[model samples]
Target: MSEFTSMAFGSAWGVKDWDESSIAPIIAREVQNSWRVRGMGDFAVGARECGSATGMLEKWKVLREDEIQKLEDVKWIGYVGVRDATTTSMAVGDTSQPTTRPWQQMIELRYGFHPEVWGKGFGTEAAKAIMGWCGKYIGAERFIAEIEIENLGSGRVLSKMGFEEIEKEKEVIWGMEGTKEWKIWVGR
Candidate 1:
């Protein structure tokens, strides 16, 4: 075996280190611009401060310390961008100003992609890669994912990955962004 790495594969995808070169911040802006995170959840969760580029910039500042701490704690898996890059869809017209947030709970599996890539199976592919990594290296017998009850796309992905609902409750999920009133899914 070539030296082992924490990153792995899912179906047709592979993981890439989401460091300085990552398009994460730009994609995050896309999500915000698309109103993907607006008015979500039945309960208020997070500070609701990530609805604008300005807000995201503030969040980017708050996440730096957490990112360092998470990696040090080994609770973080780091952001892994799927190895597919196409700049044709940047509605922002310029990606040079994109920002990568150090704020994702690295221990938790987080993902983001431009809306143009939605429904193309990339989300599922990357999620599976991260989930598989968690199972193999985390030394834990169980894993969980928080999905908004109305987030059918994510729910379907988790279900396809063999996760089942062990319980249902409204809760807060603190990620690079905040989501509230989420349905929890666990792997058996």
Candidate 2:
């Protein structure tokens, strides 16, 4: 893992380091309530269908280990996290998968924060900071976020960061819960 620094958020917010043990529970909880929110609940439901974090992590670990081996050759992506100065909670971005064209990379903004933090502009702040990290740290030229069509909040967040809608598609990966795809290009 690489070193993470604190980011400014009107107050002070630092980025936390993500390890398997520390991130597991956070992902589990996030999956549990993902569908309860208006535009996000369906995602949660899809997670449920896929067996939640337990199943997802099993696959994720393998991919991460392989990606780590090739990190030197692969481009640096971005970091995902929440901050409050005293304590920072966040996840690192993963770009190992080939979700788009050969040159295009994907960054999964996994396990952001408690729903209570929603509508507080924290999402926007964190996203912008992460994008900056992608540019400075990961050297990423572009990134993609696949969100459910109904996920208006996330759509708004992406828009706030200057992510424009490039395309929409139906996906059946999350327990067959159809997904709306959105591609966000960040960086040059």
Off by over 4 Å in 1: 1-107, 169-188
Clashes of each: 3, 3
Those runs of model 2 whose alpha carbons end farther than 4 Å from true positions after fitting are: 1-100, 169-177
Which has the greatest lDDT? 2
lDDT of 2 at 131: 56
**What global local distance difference test value does model 2 have?**
0.40
Winning model by TM-score: 2
Candidate 1 TM-score over all chains jointly = 0.35
**TM-scores of the models, in the order given:** 0.35, 0.42
Estimate the overall C-alpha local distance difference test score of candidate 1. Answer: 0.36
lDDT of 1 at 146: 46
Clashing pairs in 1: 75-107, 76-106, 76-107
C-alpha lDDT score of every prediction, in listed order:
0.36, 0.40
lDDT for each residue of candidate 1 in 154-174, tens digit (9 for 90 to 100): 566667767655322332222
